[model samples]
Target: MTDLPQELRLVTAIPGPKSQALAARKAAAVADGVGTTLSVYAAAAGGGVVVDVDGNSLIDLGSGIAVTTVGNSAPRVVDAVTAQVAAFTHTCFMVTPYDGYVEVAEALNRLTPGDHEKRTALFNSGAEAVENAVKIARAHTKRQAVVAFDHAYHGRTNLTMALTAKSMPYKSGFGPFAPETYRVPASYPYRDGGVSGPEAARTAIDLIEKQVGAGNLAAVIIEPIQGEGGFVEPAPGFLPALVAWCRENGVVFIADEVQTGFARTGDLFACDHEGIVPDLIVTAKGIAGGLPLSAVTGTAEIMNAAHVGGLGGTYGGNPLACAAALAAIETIEADGLVARAREIGELALGRLRKAQESDPRIGDVRGRGGMVAVELVKDAAGTPDPELTKQVAAAAHLRGVIVLTCGTYGNVLRLLPPLSISDELLTTGLEVLESVLAETRA
Candidate 1:
């Protein structure tokens, strides 16, 4: 990783020969359903750059879709995982409980929003964490229905598919989804007729009361800052109001902070911004540096409602992943990554917002901390322009900058640089994006 500098070095064309060859192999061997955003294969990555198979070092603004918050192969994470591997690989926390898992659970209970008596359950993926959260919520509340929001993206499993609102790519042919899941309008400030936060909350609550009815709804799951649905930070006052309503109605409020947790959002958790402590907080993506780990943290009573056997999975808290998570959490706290995320957000958003001033194609620039986005549109009236978004991202990619696209309409370009990234490297990535936007036609 020391050899992999934090600067973008284009030794060859974007994909280069080696990457092109791997792409050919991937075409032949990999499933078509599994799509990749950047075609370049990573040979090594650290700090802010990904050294591709072709030896072209690309500036990473996507942070592996918000997973590697401590950067790829971070020292603490690497050391922890290596020591754990040397000690033992897996006993499956279910079969044989481990200290690492318990330590991670303790860390989450302490770090997540609120000073309540909390308990955490570990899982392998964000989807699993969400599923387990819903199970616990239903068990605790003794209700059957759940409510999700517009532009929401929960996961790919049947139950999560029902929770997600997108169609074309995520939920197109994947129907026969879990029943009793309802959808409500999120407080998208930019497009909601200029409704205030309280107003939007009232609108959502009214719909929930009228349509789903709190009596039948066990929980209402939401991403404090929506990820694939675009980095849509709901209007201010919106979250707290909803949390209050949920508390009054005996409905579980689940904060799916899978993308916004663990210092990725310029805070330990996005819910911290509004002081809205959800009943159950589902977290992942940036939890374990680069390891696959997710957790559901909530009040002890709600978490324990699920039967003992209902929560444990074969690899729920794999020793290696738990070790990695503990180290990642340490890095976040010891390194003051919460402040770093704020710094990155200020730098990226300052530059992008400046660029937005001249580019009418950039309809909006929105986010908090390092979790920022540029929403492309056709006109000031804000007709979504997904095609233009693709062109801008492709141009940046060709120039050795790795950016990612999202949104229910696919017109949003999200920038989630690792908190470990240097200011110079992040600025350079944003420069590439600025240039791409300048040249890209609407």
Candidate 2:
């Protein structure tokens, strides 16, 4: 296990002296608009953990929101990036056209879960990828309306903000958002106001058909599992029903797998589990291992809707990110991370389900692969307990484990532990979490 580093040393309290000092500096330098998870400074990170500047090691269950799927600084990623940087940083793939960009595109096309002839357009972030997907959909369908779901998160850009359902930090003052964006109720069986998945899907489609009309709809965009909104998996028949509806209606089905892709959810893509084939798939988070790279992979016909010159950015396909992506894909394949993710899902689900059964406060325990979550509630009646969730996350942080809270109500603690995390580290982190829960209860 030493080959993977299973150390979680806490010489001082979290945000120890050094971390506090750095955080104070960061508050002045960084924008307050961006909320931080843990202010602890990273000295270095590898495998499943991050060592802070204050000499504390933390079991990183968040994985930078599922970016470092292969673990921080995998040797292959580092080697590929180092070599690529030494050669040239950015030649602007549009202008210079390097082999790395094409190779990465080829990899994405092959791996993005569709047997159809696929094409990929790489961009800088998930939002850009999402926006481009909409552009493609609109261009292909010649329609204006795009449909999203309640409790869905696409990105922070203007068009994505219009697509996003939350109103707080993402879209409080940012309106009048892009036009032609529509929202429908998602198959959130947990809190669907008593509607089943099929019912929710039918209700949503009925509403769309009434207000926007299917003929005007360009696409129906959704996250396979809503990420920022909470790790809410749809009801059994929800996604397939929606996909079929979109297919019959000529509306593009765009799966926002930015957070769920790259084996984070026990599969290469979450849509694979449902046997759903999206017309377009938007990916980011784990794509380039740790770099900022995102892409939209879709059928060649639809993706080609955008004019050749209309779908690119200056650093859309950075060589470094492409190289890292190549290595990250290879690493995921070579190390059998997909199977490892299933193992993680089984372990996490088993433990969290046990916790749920024992503690009425745990309203729900759900998620796939390493992307599991525990929703806290005040009673067995599902009264959200955001306070308890916050307390547990903070307690876990103090105990040398990093946990993140999410959901519209802020009552869910989502886990995105690296697939490479050793059994020792996984259990250790879970133990800390259980201890934190016990302390919170007391």
Candidate 3:
């Protein structure tokens, strides 16, 4: 709808004069704590290109951190939101219940993993969904402790901050965080040095048993394909073992699918990859095509444990967001984005692996579907290389490609291109990435 071209076209420098000027104004008007990855301001975005105010079209590989899986300004989402806005904006689902809200809940319940009877509750963000999942778990099991894994990034809220592992930006000085949260080791096959999945699970279980105790644990929350934790795919059998352990111990297993849900990981939910059915699934990001919406879907009995009216927010399931989510869901299903994601993953991973063959600095290449990443290292000894990661990302940005970095050691380059991105554009972005990596390494 915006008349911008779909290709990466650099008419000026990455952060051109207009963007630099706007950045100055932003510094004056916006809080310094609210950081940005790219300094360029978006005028329009769709498909795989983000047209900045300077008329430079940057190939979008991040997809707003995996939020626009259907692509920015998706036709279905735009149409749905337009119609919903024309009809009515919001009446607060809690105050004046609407069909859109119920419809979204139905969709989430039906879509999330598990054939057993389930229920869904809407929230405004991923953090809220995670928080509510913990509350429900505690209420149902009458337990006080929750287990989070190392390198996990739940959210920025007080409780989620406690769950999140990163310390610099997300958790520094943000405490005193909520209590009763414990950290356990996550299965990082690359870093675990031949540790079997079962062994990793046992190590984590031993820590939990010794420190937290099963009776005091209400939930064990994790990202199936750890998101901010460097897209670390646990070793085979890791998740299922944890799920079984939680079930046997009467602790709710919550899959924080906030970044991995909705086909981003080639599965509707990442937990589906291993056929691990969690007691609760927290979803957001890709659920609503850029709309602020999140959900906690779980077994009906566990979700119902919360007292009536114990959960909800003023804008939790805003009608417009519900409409957008429904449309996004339809787009994912009808367009076969799940299979498309796998295709994208194959393309990306193939490129990265080929690059890795020549570059020993690429420590590991891991991920599922569209969510893929390569960890950078300093040498054959495999020391994390954060500086090289930053330099490569900067190089990519200068070349009109949007890239993002992540990892516990800040030495990862993640690729989360939109499923709708064209092969031509996707190839171009990856080419830019390859060139950048080669240049940075040299």
Candidate 4:
């Protein structure tokens, strides 16, 4: 474990002199494009707080952008990784296959939703999993066109950048992206004039049929609960409708559960919430308990469509990552984290909803399980309040809390606390947010 006391403690200021020094060094050494949300350099992290180099333990609400779902340095993950490291670090799966990789594949196929005969392939990142999923879909369907939803975040790779929606940080100047990719409206209830799920689905379907006909479409990918897109949960009936359409149209429905997989969304996967099984599912982030591992799990037929030489990479399914994934999955099941995520949602959503009632600036509170967020607005008109969101999050960070802001407008305050966090720590984090939000003016 990244060992330290579990409770939040402040020995020095948030970004104390030591952290400031490191920040200066980082500025000189690291690329300017690589951004940092929190200025404090992490010394260790476990349970609910990240102990900074300055000896201040700050509450961690982002969970490394939902990567450390089982909590950073979880005992099982640490032990498994330690063992695998001692055994052997890398041999390249493409050259010499390993048992850890096969074991992880078996686990993903069995644990992921759906009882159909499935296959699994491992990758090093969510973007690779996604790219491969697209490749598999295209090969199987013998089609070229693929569809992604608005506000979706696939990855930073050229092909994925085309699939992703937001423009600024994720897809600004990196143009000449891969071709034959399209975007459709997602069922965002708050933003879509409160459109019902079925209606929203119909609108998107109509657009797809007209702009990118099903005859040419290879896949339709979506995040059951969007991650970078403000943690937006699609309205009920939306996912199922899309799945049915995709099935009828001979199109592969890909669920990008990269950030919503494993126990982060109250269920093992966000797709489980709606009982919507995708033709292919992309997972990462929480999969390895912070170790870099991702996977594409789907029906055997579609997966096999890819020629043997088509998929896989050098570091795909590294032994240490595979070991960590297995242990992390074991921890999730044994600790009843799925139910714990539900409990967290109840607590956080309740508190945030109460805050919304009191503060008009809080435009909306949405999400399920441990993945909850509040949308900041300038007025009752629901105008985005990016500045207020920034101030509130900065205030929280300065006062020893680590919250993150997201959404296309940067008006969302997303909270992804570790499931292992204590009620007291979680409650205190909420209270800190409430205080910061309350103290705000203009």
lDDT by residue (tens digit), candidate 2, 306-377: 987999999998999999999999999999999999999899889888877778898889999989989899
Question: After superposition, which runs of candidate 3 have C-alpha atoms over 4 Å from their true positions?
Answer: 1-3
TM-score, candidate 1, is: 0.99
Candidate 1 lDDT over residue span 60-159, tens digit each: 8889999998888999999999999999999988787889999999999999999999999999999999999999999999999999999999999999
lDDT of each: 0.91, 0.91, 0.94, 0.93
Candidate with the larger lDDT of 1 and 2: 1
- Flag regions of model 2 displaced more than 4 Å: 1-4, 193-195
Q: Which ten residues in a row have the lowest lDDT in candidate 4?
A: 1-10
- TM-score of every model versus the real structure: 0.99, 0.98, 0.99, 0.99
Model 2: colliding residue pairs: none
Better of 2 and 3 by TM-score: 3
Kindly report which residue pairs in candidate 1 clash with one another.
none
**Could you report the Cα RMSD, in angstroms, for every candidate shown?**
1.0, 1.3, 0.9, 1.0
Native-to-model Cα distance after best TM-score fit, residue 344 in candidate 2, in Å: 0.7
Residues 146-231 of candidate 3 have per-residue lDDT tens digits of 99999999999999999999998899988899999999999999999999998899999999999999999999999998989888
Q: Determine which window of 10 residues in candidate 1 has minimal summed lDDT.
A: 1-10
